[model samples]
Target: MTSTVDTVDPAAAEATEVSRVVISLLKGVVYQSESAQVWTLLRRFQARVTDHMTVMGLDLVIDEAEGYAHLRQATFDEANIPRLVPRHRLSFRVSLLLALLRKRLAEFDATSSDTRLIITRDQIAELLRVHLPDSSNEVRLIGDVDTLIGKVDELGFLRQVKGQEATFEVRRIIKAYIDAQWLADFDARLQAYLASMDGDGEPRG
Candidate 1:
């Protein structure tokens, strides 16, 4: 006698289907359990996904150290039809600050320690002051830095550790966004910006 197979439960089947999509979303990225939305499909199957998305020629940029992930298209040679995504435009100041923060994080990673990457407000001020124009602009500069900091925090590039007003945890996701090649290209631009600053400049000193 042949046995009949029972139909799967509708709810259970739907959950399983969603789980597969979630796994695909997590490909090549380290997802933090706390940050991920509990109800979201991506959070459900994050653990089982590990494969990179190479078929569509996209690089899954994930910084497990920073707890963030984003998709970036893979670079293609001129001989191959170059597929490109629309690049988001960021203000020059914002871009500069992000680059500096990424550089600092890279430096922090090179050091041997389990200590978190921390930077003081004063340190950030100093870094930016050297690259910004000097005048009676100290107050304005501070405000500008504060704005940039807020923006970076919102973008998940920096996290303010509790009770640490002057310090912030620079997220590792910055490294993925600001890759080595981009930094190399911006080196000269940074140098030029630094050279534009006044010798007698002091940021709230």
Candidate 2:
């Protein structure tokens, strides 16, 4: 009896590795710090991965300085191609929270040498309190702040510090989405929002 052995081709094995990187990116944001090996593979096969994603009508966004990468829907006018990625509409309050966090990140980048910005729950609440409608119930106010924080966390911009209580590390990837232009535009609208506040500090429509 004769036995035959099949061996994997080197090219096929490399292609498989690249595919794994692409799959990881499709799932969600890939952080270099979280998976150094995967990140290396991504950089090694970026072009190939990008080509594969382009075929699916998606664009790969990578910020090397920030050490993060994610996929976004391509903006080209391809009406025939349906979107594989879904667009999420954030509530006004949640948008406001994101804007506030983005602004804080800018301020931190300017003054501090450290790349990571760690903030406490109380600090976030205090930062947002002025913009929010006044309330007599302290407990309710805390709950509201917690809810907003949760939303931000779910969006992948705020990561809770392990072994820490109510403390989070604001992910630097936020700078990619909320650029300087958007921040400036939002600042004007925020002033208008503040001006529209009623006697009780609630924004009046």
> Best candidate per TM-score, number?
2
lDDT per residue as tens, model 2, 56-85: 899998999889999999987757778887
Clashing pairs in 2: none
- What lDDT would each prediction earn against the true structure? 0.65, 0.85
Backbone clashes in model 1, listed as residue pairs: none
Q: Give the TM-score of each candidate.
A: 0.60, 0.86
What does candidate 1's lDDT look like per residue over 1-205, in tens digits?
Answer: 9999999898897667555554544443334544455224444433332243455565555555556555566677754755543455776567778988888776777784754688888888888776666555555666678888888887767888899786897777777778888777777967665565454432122
